[model samples]
Target: MRRPSLPAWAWVALAAHALFVADARAAARFDAATRVFRLDGERVTYAFGINEAGQLQSLHWGGRLADGDPLGPAKSLPSHSSFDLSASITPQEFPAQGGGVFTEVALKVAYADGNRDTVLRYVSHTLERDAVTVRLRDIALPLEVSLRYTIDPGTGVIGRSARIENLGRTPLRIDQAASAAYTLAPQDDYRLHHLSGRWAGEWSLQQRPVSEGASVLESRRGSTGQQNTPWFAIDRGGSSGEDSGPVWFGALAWSGSWRISIDKDPLGAVRVVGGYNPYDFAYRLAPGERLDTPVFYAGYSDGGMGGASRLLHRFERERILPGGGKPRLRPVLYNSWEATEFAVDEAGQMALAEKAARIGVERFVVDDGWFGARNSDKAGLGDWSVNRAKFPNGLKPLIDKVHGLGMEFGLWVEPEMVNPDSDLYRAHPDWVLNFPERPRTPARNQLVLNLARRDVRDHVLQVLDALVTDNDIQFLKWDYNRNWSEPGWPQLAPEDQPKVYVEYVRNLYWILGELRRKHPKLEIESCSGGGGRIDLGIMALTDQVWPSDNTDPFDRLSMQDGFSHAYAPAAMMAWVTDSPNWVNRRETSLDYRFLSSMQGALGIGANLNHWRDADFATAARMVAAYKQVRATVQQGDLYRLISPANGSPRSATLSVSPDRRQAVLFAFLHSQSKGMQEPAIRLRGLDPRQRYRIARLGGGALPEAMPAEASGAYWMEHGLAVPMRGDFQASGFVFEAK
Candidate 1:
């Protein structure tokens, strides 16, 4: 049967109507009669309502309920005592500091007339397909706040944030402002898990019980410090495992100093407040000026910690990263830092580039000595001009050579820093961050530029824009080697000095965004003395990150395990460096180092000038093997079969493709005494009905007892064992489903 075709506009109208219907099904719902709002994801639901007092109150947040499930209207809780009023007892969605509320507040303001109290109440709201915005105003003053809620239907992750505006004629001072507050029902036992570490050691998982007091995780060092990360997970009564039980996790998307407070009140209710740190922080807003806080992303997972991480990973890959959430794969990079640290020259760089290309390196980076008089970190930081002495013919010759060798050229840059002895500082000493008549403290022989100033921000953008425009650069190893010693903005008034903390970071983000907009093909790696500035904020702007300065294979196993709890392996840039690692002076085999680095985005930082023929062959083989399985390793479901924490003697990890057609397993042994046999590792996230063929990687035979092929059910149930018999040994295998 043939039917008459409709007009183009009619077809478009029909398609639009179908889309509207689908969106309506997934959209947030607000009941005007009961003053209740509900947001539903695939497997999770979040509900809240307005109380009689006009304050927004939390209702339920957990597993999804049936469409007709009844959620009663919001009501204020009774006061426990005179000190704890009803306002404090009730779980306010966004609590202000006034109204007898003693808990961590979402907003704190000081009016011009010496009033510091603020009580916010619901005024109105607007809803979209997957988002909702609610407006609240102070009961007396002309201060307004807007709360935003966005949900991802596929992963059941919700994003929350708030915006503050001043409607009065006079200026208002904001002392404390948080993005969102999440409340959890009382449980028998609540356990908190977070990540913490230092310079040579980062991403160490720490667990503790949630007591009646506040447990604060913060970064006070301008950038996201290594001392703590802005990610957390809470499990009820320690009932959750790697892949089972209930867990709630969240991360704040801010690269500047931030805070997350987990407070378990005396009445047994647990509340989490996260946002910009109030320490040495104040923002003054005049009439009509507004400030928007960073988004706080969170989710619920009945499948446990592993499930929580997997959901977060998928959300980040599809929503947070660049390229409209579909970021490109990280290339195999070779950096010349270890080989020619401060002695970089055109000839030396080209020679290293040739060697790198021979081993399948797709990008060649010249680190730390191509510009100014940068013989060492002590000088030549702010000077962005090419060093005529090192590169007599300029960077074009070296870049052309690298391109001819079939690799992209990259360079290291630190635009946010300047050496006191550099030409730029000598020209404009007032450009760096400093206070009047106060001695400027320098870290790593450099001072942080006052990016808060428009002049300084423009200078940085111009320099970087010219660098990429003049050269055929494809990637940048953006490095920030030190923290802020004294953050100040002398150009602004005394009352506005505290705004540096917020403006500095905003300007940094602006510069990065502008650079990407100008050069669409360029990619960047965010490095702040190694894992010091990695967060959802920076990850959204950069392609990958350097996890740590300590490349010791053994230490990396533990670091990688902890890192996987919050971040995707696709953004982790692991480098295979020298043995007898500079950090620990621990010697490990080259193969072990390769295996460790293969778990993430692979990069080689070894000094090829010192390698033997056997080393080259080994590296070439490992690089090829990594190329074959990188998609699964970088963008697949990671299963931690054996954890390497607490100095465990053995560790193993498995990566299964999203389609379940392939899997890769990497196992390591620290030391085996008395021939103690390790247990077989059970596989996960595989299709039970399909058959898979086992294949060995890095040229080794499979176990004699293992079969060549088997059903996924048999492999997952019975497991497989790989032979390991020495100290610092590693092996890997691939399973191809047929």
Candidate 2:
């Protein structure tokens, strides 16, 4: 007896959905059949190569035609249109870095014929973390197009390949390499702002200028082909193909842009497109031959940073749990890196635990220095076993005590590293990435693991699994302390070694996936030294990210601003660093650090145990204030109302709210001239009709009395202003919807 068959149309609809849903097949661990792909396996399971929750993955796409066949003949696109186009060649897959995703759709237009050229339309959707997106669309009446995605180490930005090929027959000639753009919703307060250009190798971030200003194109050596000249863009035109778009690209003084190029024409081979980033240009394709290679990333973030956050959550599912549940992060957490350092003993841990429990901190994390023979950074990185010197009776007692005290216990681990001075390195010298005969290059007092090798990745996984599976560890701070240096791994093929970046990152995803599945509720925060690895690719795997190395409140204006450019303020891991400073002379009032870092995931990076009673009182009050505003800030629409980068030391103001019902504003009085009057700060993106009440944050800190300095008037007539008479200070204002 057979069940009734579905209607023919229904069957077809179901099949289309299945194929549309699955751009490619992954392992059983991930059923691409569903929108959510759980990245849990040694084999590649996620089409998204990397998953750094905050922002760490950079994407690239490379492809070519099977035959040197120009998509000879022009045709129309899928949408309502009459004008059609053709392509030289179309490739299948894009490169993956850690947890990234991209799909190339090919539309076979009218078939190639002498009357006209049929089009092979190539388009793609790339997810760089959850926020950044790159969308590529190009059509040639008869020309070819190509590109590459390369990371520029110098600038910490990504650049494009410099070549485009002609897989067609006849001498292909393109008028020029042009037509590439990026799109964003206009509602976002942030603009596609430009940074200086010095890092040509990496069109990622620039502090040095390759060029500047509007109406001009900037040129620098390409990161991919290392060509003599390349192009970049800022903001320009509208959303249209064939040189009409908002992206500022191709040659000039105006800063900001990924690489792009133009091509005059190449006889029968590949011509040059925008170079440096795009490898080369399209050429005339001969039958049975194909055009080749590309590198690029296309990403999209809806309402600036918040939009990016949502996109990230949609993919990674990293969020705070309403009620404690499996796969949820403990509401309160404490770590000991800056608090106790390495010199502390068990008594110190116990004391910290005591304070932690009082504050409702549900977990206590012991950062580095508790593993192997490590009493300090000089030893015990690769050895995962507990150091008898630090914990004579093993981690069990501390775990038991923390549990008894009503808190979970977590620890830090840098599994992708090996301290040459440790036992692991001695046993497997070959496990470190290097040419068999070359000297091992160490970084951060350690060497990168050769995850490209089966054994090395397996070992890292085993140790990690042991820590999670064998102990009562509830969380992990997965730290990658260094970047890739001398990135040669003998275990991989020369061509495939290029895949190492994607592979190394994939290896990381594998470990995280395994641990998450087994523990089901293990929390992880991905950290890189401090923030070098903060990108979308890495964010997919972890819950949060460290925004930067500098934690000064004043300095945060720039660092946090830069981070918020591609990441959400909510995901930022900001801590209160020591004052007068632990690393710099920037002495920010405790009030400032707490408020600024409160814009993101809040934590105490400085020594909390040693804090003066006054500091604790101040913190308790401020943390409470944060609790009130945290929801709005985390889920509000961010507006870049003002910027110090615009040369106004007067201050910068950022506002947020769910439906404009409530608002929070931070206005800092930067710099003070002997006789200069205060500058008037204009506010935008507000409902002028609605009134708002104002109050200084943590105003309750003074129980004896409310100082006029702490209490302030809320106004709409002149907006809000803070004094800057002598040395500058930071102030925050709250605007409640009236």
Candidate 3:
């Protein structure tokens, strides 16, 4: 990987003053007696705060009630609220503020009517040399929403960005968001706009592969609600536009605010910023850090996903690429289903790993069958240990074999669920989560682990900790297969069972947090029976998620599109030719298969040993081309090239790396009609100034182009020749911009 040079403007700021030009504005009050931050708005009063480190606090929404409204006398939904609050720092984490200048910040919400409400939030603060941990113990009212503001390390401006977690019992469900009045004391222009593009590259875990898969695709229908993706740049009391600058104010929680801001950059570009990277380095909030005082930033992006990235880098210009480096992973790799699946003998397992390594892969992840009991997916899940029957030689040797092949080894673990037939379940029935005297239910041949139990938590910690300490596992695909529909925590009292939901989630966080801390090099991925639990809430914990189990290229066209609404292409686990098309009725060609997977994390989920020589040759080229322009795909502004075809030759393209340096364009052609002409689709998200080298996988002519505009492609005025053709399934093209 190569390092990117800092912008020349940033170099100038490096030599400029960093603290003397600090500005402070006081509008809301932080109250010590009440322990809540209060922000007064034109229509309502916003008062709220959090103290729970890994736990949750409460939110109260009240204002002058109308006579006709029922909320005041009897109960109604308009003016009442009780939200469970969480921290960047887990609440239960015993924090010791080796005392200094640490301050606390939070969000406050109030209801005015059914269609109106008021919101007040704080921003994440910047990091300084004299920084130390300070857990937010309590939040009393009138304690003006503020943090110990520090001068930006690179730009000298006082900056703060934080995340407010809504860990309530039921999802609060945000409809339309409106800002009351805000204190516009800092900048003369209170201009707020919609931002576009990628985010600043300064976050602790800004995994490019994950970010690319984590986009929030626009919603046309209402089956799946819109994703609460946080953006930077929106002024309270001003008209919203498409321009951006610095996001210096506002204190809002993450789930509660989908309407973030877009600030003005020196240029007219609607630059985006935020997401807790400004104030701290990329260290897991472990041993020495405070627990409860955590936060996340939501910005405003007009260019949708593209806008968000632009706003992110605006404020975080200096540390965009921490070491200012180039990205390597393009979310492309191969994963085996059995490294942790039903018991498989060491010889059989080694064969699979060996084959995967030989298939032009950077990561060879062993999935489920490698750990626990006898052969079959029905046995050991939470056991987290090697079953001698399958791997007599132990995991270290297997990992060593993978390492010797020069490929990264990844393992699987369902830390939050277990199988009743395992040792952990047999010895401790209490560890199994179920209703009293109720028949046990099953999903994926496994039972849910009662994470709320202290003993159960201890067992999980022990198992995971050892997995990391024992083998040379570089990545752990942590999976949670079900939702918390049946609220049952055996250990908690009947009355306290309601509290179990929050507790279980907290314990899970604790376990993951501890693991990341103990093993900083550990790469964690969270998968929930495939996209079952995809949301911003989980992104804070894991890097990427398995978008779905249906790896069929045809089915993925819609599934992946649906997932893009709230996630990026980087977070989606796309496999190249996994088994057969799980949906529809046809064998998808490998070229189409590779093109299908190219849109997201590229991986091979099928038996690599079954691949033909031609397949190997094609796979090698795709991987090489992928590495060449992954940064453009993962971090550059994204644009949809072709409209989705219901059943005809469906095709689309994503032009990644738009600064004109390098770009990757992918297109997939589905179905070949007897008398139809092959579609030639024009590309999107490209720079007209930079010429690109276009190539095909098997063999085809390169796509020609006309002209483009800042808004979008002008050539498509109509579509072009399809990127690929065959079983009418999938195919991709590589367009490298230089």
lDDT of 1 by residue, 1-738 (tens): 975698886766566445434554764877654567888887999989899999999998888877647775789898999988999879998999998999989899999999999999999899887999999999989999999999898888889999999999999999999999999988868899999999979999999988888999999888898999999999876578888888989999998899999988668888999999999889999899999999999899998888888888888888888868777888999999989999999888988998898889999999998899899999999899999999998999999999999999899999999999899999999998888899999999999999889999999999999999999999999999888867888788888998888888899999999999999999999998889999999999999998898889899999999999999998999999998888889999899999999999999999999999899999999999999999999889998889999878999999999999999999999889899998888888889999999988776678788798998898789998777898999989999987
Candidate 1 overall Cα lDDT vs. reference?
0.90
Q: Write the residue-wise lDDT of candidate 2 on 1-738 in tens digits.
A: 984698886765566446433633221111212222122112111122122121112111111112212221222112122221111211112211111111111111121453222222233323222122322222444433333332221111223332334444543322123222221212211223322222111112222222112122232211111111122223312331211222322221111111332211111111122211121212233333333222322223213333332332322222222122122322446777877777655777888787666544566888888888777776778999987777888888888999999988889888888888899988988787776667766766888877767788888888888887878888788877665556666766543343343345556667777777777777778675566454444555566766555666766666655554445555566776678766568677787777777666677666777778788777767766776776666555555556555456755545556476666676666677677766555454456676655566667322122222211122433555554455446666566665
Deviating ranges (above 4 Å) for candidate 3: 1-297, 304-332, 338-343, 645-649, 672-680, 697-731
Q: Work out how many backbone clashes candidate 1 has.
A: 0
Candidate 1 minimal-lDDT segment of 10 residues: 15-24
Query: Can you rank all candidates by lDDT, best first?
Result: 1, 2, 3
Question: What local lDDT does model 2 show for residue 644?
Answer: 50
TM-score, one value per model: 0.96, 0.63, 0.61
**Pairs that clash in candidate 1:** none
Tens-place lDDT per residue, model 3, 159-248, is 233222233222221212122112222333443322122111000111111111112222111101122224223332233222232232
- lDDT scores for all predictions? 0.90, 0.48, 0.47
Number of clashes in every candidate structure? Answer: 0, 106, 126
Off by over 4 Å in 2: 1-233, 237-333, 356-363, 403-408, 492-498, 675-677, 680-691, 700-718
TM-score of candidate 3 to 2 decimals? 0.61
Kindly provide the TM-score of model 1 when superposed on the true structure, using C-alpha atoms: 0.96
Best lDDT among the predictions, by candidate number: 1
lDDT of 3: 0.47
